[model samples]
Target chain A: MKVKVGMMSFAHLHADSYAHCLLNNPRAEFVGIADHDLRRAQQKAEQHGVQAFDSYESLLASDVQAVIICSENVKHAPLAQMAAAAGKHILCEKPLMTRLEDGQAMLTAARGAGVQLFTAFPCRFSPAFQQLRAMVQAGEIGELLAMRGTNRGVNPGGWFNDPELAGGGAMMDHTVHVADLMRLLTGQEIVEVYAETNNLMYHGNFDDVAMLTLTFEQGIFATLDSSWSRPRTFPTWGDVTLTVYGTRGVIEMDMFAQYLRHYDDRAGRIRQVFWGDNIDALMIDEFLRAVAGEPATTLATGEDGYKAAAVAIAGYESIRRGEPVKV
Target chain B: MPYFSGNGLSDTCPRRAGNLSSVVNLLTEDAMVKVGIVGLGTMGRQHAEAYRQMPDVQLSVVYDRHMDRAEAFAQEFGATVAHDLSEFLKGCEIVDICTPTYRHTEYALAAIQAGKAVVCEKPLARTLQECEQIVEAVHRHNALLMPAHVLRFFPEYRTAHQLVKAGALGTVAAVRMRRGGDFPRTKSDWYADFEKSGGIIMDLIIHDLDWVRWTLGEVERVYAKSLTFRHLEHLDYTLVTLRLRSGTIAHIEGTWCDPGGFRVSFEICGDAGMLEYDSQQMVALRVARRAEAGQAGGVEVPESPAVENPYYRELRHFIDCYRAGQSPEITVEDGMEAVRLTLAAIESARTGKVVKF
Candidate 1:
């Protein structure tokens, strides 16, 4: 039987991508979608050929075995709680929640209800990162000393720039990906975090550029540059890259480099012709498998999401205190 | 594509910002301006070559503490050698101080006292005190002073600046600039000595510091960290975070640890779009339009116009400004500000705290 999967909200831009993954994945049935904005949800559902529900309760009342929470950062906890209480498996987005306490509540609710909860961190599904992780695990670079990562992209505005909805700015938007990746790859918890954030590029109300230095348990350290610094002319949005330095060797991975440059003079621009594997599809496959009895190794638990969010939440605290903070 | 002659310039000429009618008239009236150069180092040689290529200026004299280098440079550039500082100032209406940072004030003061326009290579001077001395000399002697913040003359950087000014990219939100090179091998290896060259933060990254300040505005505060190869050798690296008063943040990274050639890159983001240039990519700058209001727009990586030698362009602007009886594109105070900000970064790295301007 195909796993029944539905989307909660289309507030996050990733909602459509995840929906497409569910539609395409033969192992999962595209159930339905529900959003606070029913008209917007219907529009998205029409494009994906799925049912649209006007209310969260109505969608949960239906036969959705699993629900993907793709709402604003602040709304994640509430939405996840509703889905968990309805006894549905959950796949929440990057930031589990803006607040650590809220993230904890979502985890408690899902655990109490005896449901599987996953975080949508699809970067782990990229073949390049998978290879890098494998090599690191195999001790190709010996024990890790330091790693440097960058997740610079074009600023995706909307709730992302709004502190009320998104919770923070570039630091909040970008920190979780690299933070989670570092923790997952090294199998170590981040012990401390120090961050420097500012809105220098657009001089907007929120910060768009930041540098976060994280120290992991076992004395591993990493620096993450999370800025929306890519220009419009870049072939792609930007890159999620990591350069890992270990005792024996070094590993450099550009997760999005598997693309051919497509320059169209008629359009007066260049575009990336991606030839890489569909990471979203791979991630959705893992989620469905985990929904069954067996689980994937790279499967990100709600605990993984909470740990990453803890680092990011503590990062904001460090920025406020003007010093390093423990995670 | 349009190559205008030295004296004949159109209103759209990239050389001047505004009406060059006054400059044209002044150029027609004045003789080819005689320029003297102090210091026969790499920068001095570059200035001499650039001036030699210009029809509107004459490289009249060259000087260095080591007279052999000066003589060698003068012979190649068709200029005379000056054995001393004052002798170098005697034959020219303008002085290009390409000396070590510590000697900038001495040559600048001599040129100012002699009532000549002065163009000093960047950082203005090594210390805030020396920078102020040069500024005071400019004020006291009523001289025209231009600091060579040459990045402003580069086509890609200039285009980015013009786009921002024209509101094409909207408001700047963040910037990331990187500049790196192998350890400078000078005759005295002056760059290795922190007291003289102010190391990589002052000597190398100041170019980016000035460019960002020029494009954005004043830096409100700074936090920085660095790694020095003093224990291993002479390499140096620094990463500085600058928060602008306009609520923009910038990260400037500088390193003298490159095994070979030098490179510079900048990425500027705005609300509407972004401007990026990476020398390592060896591609034209990339600009992207915001996907807005249901419009699906991707990036536009257009080929950039041919880049002129910015060293030549910077010198040309200085000469043109001097002829037009106008101040330089980069003022003495602008140079002073860059030095102050860079010094503050050094302090931040030392004190392990943010330095507010």
Candidate 2:
């Protein structure tokens, strides 16, 4: 028996990618999709040959045993709680919640209802990142001293720039990825953070970019520069590079370095394509595989999402008040 | 493909912003000309060392408000220590002044009144009134005055400038330059004083803004935002946006919180292809595809700093102008114009409106 999966909305940009993954994965069946935007929902549903529902209540009442909630960041927590209550496993996207209290309640509900919960942060599965982690563990990089990582991009406006809907601007949008990657790669909780956020390019109400630095519990220092203001001419897939200076040797990689092949053979020449497409689907496939008792490492645990949220939100507070904020 | 001049210029003509060559051919004197340095601070000493490197340049005198600083530079360079402004200019044909902005008017007038050539450090004067005063003095004396705009001497920046000029890329459409560094545990300290640094735009982005203007043409209008974003007891960062008279737009970022030491990058976009270069990267020159091939790495950036510093090249250029009757890489007008645009940028940032030149 295959696991049945349904998506909550076409409102979130990555939703269609998740739906395609579920339908395409032999181990999972595409149950249905629901969204306020019927045109978008219909477009995605028809493209993937899946059922489309007009309302969340109908989608939630479906026979699927699991749900992937790829909604506006603010909807992540509430939607996760609803899915957990419906006796369905949940795959919520990062920024588990903008507010800590909501995130705590979602975790509490997941535990009380005995439902598994995960957040979508697929950076951990990158082969290069995994290689970096193994090298650190093996003492190949002895006593990690410092690290710098940048995940910058042009603004993906819509809900992303809306502080209320996206939780916050660059601080909320980007710091979580680095904070989680920090905990994932270094195994140290952030002890303190001092940050400054800038609205250098996009200025009316939102800060389209932010530069943040943190001190981790284990005495390592790291800097993460995040932005939604990278020039549009930069490769759309974006660049996330990590440079770790260790006791033995310094290791650095343009994470997209491995993406040096042609995806379209008919084209005259190989074009530049950075990210592995279908990441949303790929992460979903791994989560479904884990639930089926297949071999799998932990997907971004709700705890991972919670911590990333705490630190990301704290960084926002620090920028607002102009001081360090504890996580 | 940009028709890059082997000389490192784009299709643009000479006597403009954003052009330089990497392979160094320093000024050598057929006949040595006497030179004097008016300040003995870090920048002043760099000026002296630069002069000493030129075979045709002779350090005639050294003077600083502080006698000790002046005497030290004089002894190191085998130059006489000048007791007063008149004595310094009497012996030297050219005067290099690196004094604070307020003092520029005092000594620059003295040098020009004595009919000596002059090179002053940037922010040529404390205010527009002072800049105008210096300009009047230069015109009054028919005195040659060059401001030390050393960024023009940076090889990579020179290439970007020339690439735009030579028209391999057509009219330059846009430019981006970034200059930043970690919060210096040590700064000039006086840098924190509002009157001295002229905030971020004048102190830092002035260099990049001048580079932008050099690459494109003159800026017709400017908009800027500034803030003390970090905890260094100063205005730590500023970003300036420029609209050139030629319809090019430029963005310059200047900050003191790189948090990892200095980082510098410059990029220019044109209709046919774009050129981008960074000091942090292995490849400095990137061009669009040419007739038969894709854009090639036009030049290789050394991982290490150039064996000869840019300041050295700038001083050599000055010496060539003074002794060999050669034109400087960055002439006096370039310096004055950079200062002019810098003051306009500061005004725009302060008033929160577009400032026109």
| Best prediction by lDDT | 1
Pick the DockQ winner: 1
DockQ of each: 0.32, 0.05
Q: Which regions of candidate 2 deviate over 4 angstroms?
A: A260-271, A275-282, A294-298, B1-31, B34-55, B58-152, B157-276, B279-309, B317-357
For residues A1-327, what per-residue lDDT tens digits would candidate 1 score against the true structure?
A: 999988999999888888888988889999888999999889988999989898999999999899999999999999999999999999999899889889989999999999999999999888999899999999987766667788988779898999999989888888888888999899899998878777756567887777776777876656688887776566788789987765555676889888998888988999998899999889999999988767667868999999988887887898898776889
User: lDDT of each structure?
Assistant: 0.81, 0.70
* Candidate 1 chain A worst ten-residue window by lDDT: A243-252
TM-score, cand. 2 vs. native: 0.61
Candidate 1, number of clashes: 18
Alpha carbon lDDT at B86, candidate 1: 75
* Cα DockQ of the candidate 1 complex: 0.32
| Positional deviation of residue A53's Cα in model 1 after best superposition, in angstroms | 8.4
